[model samples]
Target: MTQQTQEPTTAELSAGYAAGLDPREVAETILTRIAAREPVLNAFYLHDPAQVRTDAAASAARWAAGTQRSAYDGVPVTVKENIPRAGHPVPSGTAIANPPVAATNAPVTDRLLEAGMVILGSTTMPDWGMLSSGVSSLHGVSRNAWDPSLTTGGSSAGAGAAAAAGYGPLHVGTDIGGSIRLPGTWAGLATLKPSAGLVPLHAPYLGRVAGPLTRTIADSAALMSIISRPDARDYSTRPYPQMDWNKRLSSPRGLRVGLQLDAGSGAPVDPEVAAAVQLAAELFAAAGATVVPVAPFMSAAMLTGIDAFWRTRSWADYRALDEAAQASVLPYIARWCSAGKDSDGAATIENYQRFAQLQQVTRQATESLDLVLSPVAPMAAFGAEHPMPSNDPDEPMSHISFTLPYNMSGQPAATVNCGFTTDGRTIGLQVAGRTGADEDVLAACAWFEGVRGDAAPDWSLVP
Candidate 1:
C-alpha cells in the first residue's frame, strides 16, 4: 500500500517504515514515479535503477532486524549534480566530455550516506550553474512537474522538478543568487537557502550554501538537520551547532516582519505575484506579527556590478577550457561569459566590492525587522526553453533581485507557495531573516505553510 500512495512526505514515509512497511516498497514507489515523470521533466542527470534497488534491499534488511541506521535510514534523497559524490562525475551543468569524477564525497553527501539515506543520484542544472532557468548545455531542459511547458527554475532546476514530482522525500540543492528558492517557487515546493556557511560545502564561495527542497516545510527542516552537520573540509563553515531542526514550530507573535514588494532593480513584479505576496504579509499581520514595509536594499549598480563579477569569474573558468569544451557550453552562457573578457582589472575589483556594499545595505535595511517577506521571483514560471525570464544574455540577472540580497548578506531565506498565478503557475512568498536566524526563518515558513492550507497541485494529474 505504501507503493500506492501519492507524494508521501518524510513523516508519512517514516511512519510507514516503522509500521513494518518494506523499504523496497517505498523505493519502488519512488522509482515508479521517476519512470513516469522523468521523460517529461528531464529532472535527473544520473539515475541507476539497479543501485536504487540494491540500497533499498539493504535498508529493508536493517529495518526488519530493528537495526536501522537512523530515523531516515531508508528514506530516498537526491543531490544536485554539483555536489561531489565520489566516483560520480560532477559536470556542473556543462557539456565537457569525460568531466572529472569526484575523488571523495562532499561533506553533505557523506553526512547523508552516513545516516543511511538512499541517494537517488544527482539532478540536472543549467550550464556551469549560471542560469536561473532549466535549460542546460549538457542535460537539456528540465521542465516543471506542474507543467512541462513551464520551467523548473534553476540552477537547482532538476531538484525542484524532482521534489515537485514526488521523486522522493528529500532533495539537496545549492543556492547562490536564488538558485534553490527560485526553483522551489516555480516548482511549488518548500525550499531553504541556508545562511552562508551554515551547510558545509565541498567548495564554499561567497553567497553559496547547500540546502533542501521538498514538498513540505517539515521535510525541508528534517533534511537540513542531516546536511548541516559540520565537516572540516569546508574551512568557511561556522562552528557546528546542533539543533532539532524538525522541532516543534513556534508562534510568530511579537515578531517584527518587513514586507518588501519592490525588488528595486529587477523587472517589476507581476501584478499577480505582487498580490500574492501582499496577501502573505496580511496573513502574517493577522497572526499577531507586526508587519511593516521595508525599503528595497538593492540598487541597479549593485546588481549589475555583482553580475559583472560573476561573469568574470565564469569567464576565468571558461577560458581555461580547451576550445572544444568551451564551444560545447550553452550558447547563452558562452555569450554571457564572453562579456566578462571585456572587463579590466580595475573594473572587476570595483565590481567585486559591490558584494560588501550589498551585504552592508541589506543588513542595515533589515536590522530592526525580525524577518522580511518578498516574492521569490518577480514573476511566475516562464518558458522551459529560455535561459532566463528576459531571455537576454546582457540582462541576465534581472529576476534575481529579490533572492540575491540574502545570499550577499549571508542571511537565511526560504520560499513557500503562497498562491497561484492567473494561469495557474505557483507563486512563492520568500521569508528571510538576518544571519544566524535560519531557525527563525524556517519556523516562520512552517507556520505559514500551516496557514496556507493545501494549495499544492496534485502530482497525479500532471500530464
Candidate 2:
C-alpha cells in the first residue's frame, strides 16, 4: 500500500499487516514522527532508528512467512528509562557519567521483545523516580503534549508524554505512588497500575509495580496481558490465571461504584477536575450501574505516615550514593532524601502502624463496592520545571491524595481521560478495585472509555 503518514493504534497496525501493509513501512512512519516531535517533547532518551528498522524488517518477514509471534508483533512500543533493556544504561534519569549498560533485559522488556514488538526507545523519568514532574538533571524536562508549557506528570513522565503525542500505541511505566496514573491523567491518556505482585518488579519495593500507558484502555489491556506473564527473575510475581483482557470490556450494568470527590487532605481540587469525575459517575449511573457518593476514608495522618515511609525508602537510595554523586541529584530530591535520613526504627514502626490503619479503613470502605472513582490528580498539569504546583511541603504529597493510599493498600488502580478543562488542560477519572482485582479495574476503565470515547490529543497541533 501507499506509505502511511499518520499514527495507527496497535489494533490498526495488526489489521494493516493482514491488508498487505509492510511492518517496515509502519516503523519508518513512527521513526519519522519521533524525529519530528522529539525536539519539542523530549520524550525519549535512547532511540536507535537503525535498530528499530532491523526489528521491524524481521517482523515483516515473519508475517510474510505466516509465523507471527503475537497480535502486536509489528507494533511499536516504548519503555520507561528505569526499566532495563540489554545494552542500554539504566540511568534512572540521573547525571552519572558512564553508567554501566544493562547486561540483561528487565522482565517486562523481555516479555515485550518476545511478543515481537518493535522497541521505539526508552522514555525519560525523574532521578530515582522520586519527583512528580518530568524535569530531571540528566534528561531535562519532558513536556506535556497538549501544552508544552505545562509539566508531564512523573515519574512516568516521558511514557505519558510519548503515548499522548502518538509516539506509539503502547508504553510501559513504573509506579510506586501515582507515577503512572498521574502522568496519564495530565497527558490525557489511559494507564493502569496493577496490584502489587501482579506484574513483576525488576527491583522490588513495598508498592512498586510496572504497567502500561496507552491511548485507549484496549491497548493498555493488550500490553498488560503480555507483560503480566510470569518472570522467573522476579520471585515476587504471583502466579496469575491466563485470561483475555480484551474480551473483558462490557457495560458496568450491575457494578457498584463509589464516587469520592475530595481526598479529604484539605487539598484544593479544581472545579473542572471535580466535574469530570462527577461526570464519570453520572455516566456509570446512566449505564445502569449503582453509583453512590462516598466520603474519603483516608486521613491526612495516614498520608503523612505513608509519605514518611516513601521518604525513608528514597533516603536509603540516596545514602548509597557517594558524596560526590549525591551532590549531582536534583535539589528537591536531595531535600526529600535528607528529610528521612534521620528516621529511626521507632519512626519506621510508627509509619507501618499508620499504614495498617489506612489499609484497614480502605478495606472496609471498598469492601462492598466494585470500584471507586476519583480525580487522578487534584489539579491539571502545572509548570513544566517545578517539582509541584506549590512550594508548601504538604502540597506535593497532597496532590497524590487519591493515588498514594491505593499504593499503600496494594489495590489495582487506573486512570482514563474523562474531559478537558476550559483552558485546554486534560482531566482524568481514577477507577480502583480491591486487591487482586486488576482485571476488574481494567474492565471498568474500558467501560469508561466507551462512555467518554478514546480520543487522544491531536499531536499535529503540537509545535
Candidate 3:
C-alpha cells in the first residue's frame, strides 16, 4: 500500500479493516512514524510501543470477530499531557520530579479507549498550559511542522505538531485561551474549542474544554461524536445524546457570517494575515453565506481583565508549590505568577465584571449572525523560543485578543487553515457561534474546509 494510504483516518481505518487491512499493521506504521519524527518535533510526552501494540492486537481480534467497538476502531490518537490516562503521569509539562500517576482515565480518554482507538501517547504542552508558544521547561519545545524555527502554538503544542506531521489522524487538546486553535492555525490543521461543557472536563473551570486537532474535519467530528457524551464525573457536562456531528456538515447557504478584523485592541495584523481572512470571508460568500464586516467588539480592558483572571489562577497554583519548585518553572511562567500575585479579591471580582461586559458585547455583536469569523491569531507563527511575537514587557496577551473572548462567553469556536503567507506560514480563520451552537460552529468549519480543499503544508519538506 502507498504511504499516504497507510495512515488512515478514523473512518478510513474502520473501512480499511473490512477491506482486509490488519489493525496491527496500521498500528505498527504509526509507531514507526512516531519514532522517526518525534525527536525533531518533541510531540509525544510518553509513548509506549508495547501498550499500543497490545491495544492494536485487541482491536484486530474484535474486527475479525465482527465485534468492532466503534467507528474509530484501531485509529491512533494522542492526548495532551495535562489530560490524565490510567497509570500515566499527569505532569502538566512542569519540571517537578516524580509527578503522581493518574489512577483513572480522564473522561475524554476513557471515551476514546471505549471506542477502540489506539492511544499513541500523551502530547506535550507549556508548563501548566499557560503559554501560547510551546516552550515548556519539562519537555523542551514543540517545533512547527512548516518551519521548525517557528513555534507550534501551545498549550496543546505537541498535539498540533503531531497532527501536522501526520503522526496520526486524531489528536486531543484542551483550550482555555486559544490553546487548541492557536496551535492548529500555526501548524495548518483543523481544531475545535467546543461550547463550555459540551465536552466534559474533569475538575470544571471557566474557559476550558478538551477538543480534537485533525488534518480533516470529518476525523474531528468523528472524535467529537465519542468524546462529547455526558460524563457523570463532570457535573457541568450537558447531555449530548445521539448527536451525529458528522452529519451536521452541509453547504452553509444563508448563514450570516460576521467578519471582524480586529478585536478593538489596535494590535497590528500582518497584511497577509488580513488578506487571508478576507479571502476566507469571500469563500463563505461564494458558498451562499452573507459575509458582513463587523466592528471589533472586544476592548483593551476586556483583554487585560481576562489575562489577569487567568494569571491569578496561575499565581495561585504557583504559590501552592514549594519555593524551589516554583523557582524551577520557566522564567516566563514565573513572571506571569509574579505579575498577578498582588491581585486582591476585588481584582478577581472586577475581572468577572469585565467578563460579563465582554460577554454582553459578544452576544450583541453576534446576535443577528449565524457565525462570527476572524483571524485566529494576529500574525503567522513566530520564533519558537519566545513567549510572544513582541519583546515588549506589557504586551503578553496581544496575540490572543481574537480567541480569548469566546472562552469568556462560553461559545463554541473553531479554526481552519485559510491560506498561506508568501514565506509559507499558514493562516487560520476563526469561526465562533452562539453559546450552545457547537454543531453550527463545526459545520461552518467543515464547509470552509470543503471550499478550501486540503491546505495542509508538505510536512516531508520540513527539516
Candidate 4:
C-alpha cells in the first residue's frame, strides 16, 4: 500500500489512483480545501466546482473501465491567468473591465488537458505581469500560504500560493524574470524557470517561458514530462529530446559547483537568507561535489540597463490602452512605467543591449562550473499589501537580482526551501545549471529534497 502523506504529491497520488482510489473523491477533497482557504489566500481568479466534478467523474469512469489516460490522468492542476485556456479571460491581473477571453489554449495548457489532467482554474498575477510582488489591481492581494500577512511574490503570485496551500499537486506559472522563483522562494514551494525555449510558448519572447510550481521536485519532473512536448507555435524553441524526467537522481559526485553569495546588484542578501543558502552549499560539498566560490559578475549598470529596457516595453503596453483603461492600472505599475514615457529609439536600443551583455557576462562567469548555488532573493518575505520589497516604483527590480540573470542567459534554475528565518519566513536555495542542462538542475534539486527532509511548511498557519 502507498504510504499516506500530508501533502498529496503527484507520485503518491498516482499510486493511490492505481490502487483503486476514485478521482471524484480526490476532486472533492481538493475543492473542500480550496473553499476553506480561498478567503485568506485569494489564490484562484476562476474556479468552477461543477466543471471540476464533471472532469473527475469522466476520469473515475475511465479508471473503473481498466483504462486511464496517463499516470497523472486524474490529477488536478491550476494554470496561471497568462497561460490561456479556451473560453477564459486573460486579464493579466489588470483592472481593465471585461478583459479579452482567450480563443485557444496555450501549448502547455493543451498538453496538460491532453494528458487528462483536470484544470482547477486560473490563478492570479500582478498587473501586466510586471511587479515581483502580489498586490494585483485585478485579483486583489494574493497572500503567502504559510503566513497570510506576508507577500506571496509575483507575478506568479497565485500559482505559488496554490502550490503552497495544496490546491493541487501541479500549478503552472510563467517566468520572465523571477516570477516563478521569487514566489516559490517566499511561499516555500518547489518551482523551476526552465531554459528559454525549452518549453514551447505561444508568445515567446527574449526571456519568457512557462514552468511548474509544486510541493516536490519529483512532482515538478512529472509535470515537465508532459509540458515539454513539441509545439509548432513557438518559433524560438530548441531541439529538446524526450527522456524520463522522473528518473532516479543521484548525488552530485565529482561535479564542480559554484557558490555565489553576492549578486553584484540590487538589494544585498539578508544575513538569514545568506546563512541558509550557505548551509545548502555545504551539503553539496559533503556529498562529494567540489564547491568553489564564484565572484559576482552582474553589475549595477547591467541591472539598470535591463530595467530601462523593461520599463520602455511596459510603457508601450500602458500607453496603448485607452484613457479609462490606463487609469485603471495599479498605481505603482503606472508610476514605474511612466518613467519611460519619453524614451527615444536610440535610448531603447542602448538599453536593450544590456540583455546581450548580461548573457555574455553570465556565460563567462559560469563557464567552468557544472552548477551554481545562490539565494533565490535578498530577503525571505515582504508585506502582502506592498507591491515589492522596496515598495518604490523607481527601484522595482531590486529583489530579482539573483533569479533574473538565469532567465536572460537561458539557464535552467530551480528553487527549493532550505531553511526559515528567525521570525519564521521561508528561505530558498537556488540551483542553476549550464544552458540546456535541465535534467542536471532537476536532479540536483531532487537530491537536495531528499537530504533536507521534513522542512515542509505548517499548513495550519495558512488561514
lDDT (tens digit, per residue) of candidate 4 on 295-356? 99888988887888889999998999999999899999999999887679998898899898
What is the per-residue lDDT of model 2 for residues 1-463, given as tens digits with 9 covering 90 to 100?
1232356777888899877789999888778877877797899988899999999999999999988899788889999998999888998988866677899899999999999999999999988887888989799889987778999899998998888777879999999879999998898888999987888777877778999999888888888888988887887777667756876657888989999997877477999899888888998999889998878887888877877877887888888889878888877778876778677999988987877787678778888999999999889889998876664443338788888778778888999889888888889889999888888888888877766753345445544
Cα lDDT of model 1 by residue, 1-463, tens digit = 1232467788787888889988898898789889987888999999998999999999989999999888888899999999999998999998889999999999999999888889998999999889998999899999998889999999999999989888898999999899999998898889999988889999999999999999888999889888888888899998736666866555678999999999889899999999989988988898899999988879999999999999999999999999899889999999998899999999999999999999999999998999999999998999999999999998858999999999999999999999998878999999999888787788888898878765555556555
* Cα misplacement distance, residue 132 of candidate 2 (Å): 1.0
Cα lDDT for residue 341, candidate 1:
97
Error of 4 at 211 (Å): 0.5
Residue-pair clashes per prediction, in order, are 0, 0, 0, 0
Q: Between 2 and 3, whose TM-score is larger?
A: 3
Q: Write the per-residue lDDT of candidate 3 for residues 189-269, one digit (tens) a residue.
A: 889898888888776887788999988778888889888888899988875446558666577788888999978873678
Top of the candidates by lDDT: 1
In model 4, state the lDDT of residue 393.
Answer: 91
Candidate 4 TM-score versus the reference: 0.97
Model 2 poorest ten-residue lDDT run: 454-463
Any runs in candidate 3 off by more than 4 Å, and if so which? 1-6, 240-242, 248-250, 391-394, 453-463
Clashing pairs in 4: none
Candidate 2, position 305, lDDT: 81
Which order, best to worst by lDDT?
A: 1, 4, 2, 3
Model 2 vs truth, CA RMSD: 2.6
**Candidate 2, TM-score vs. the true structure?**
0.94
User: Looking at candidate 1, what is the lDDT of residue 226?
Assistant: 86
The regions of model 4 sitting more than 4 angstroms off are 1-5, 453-463
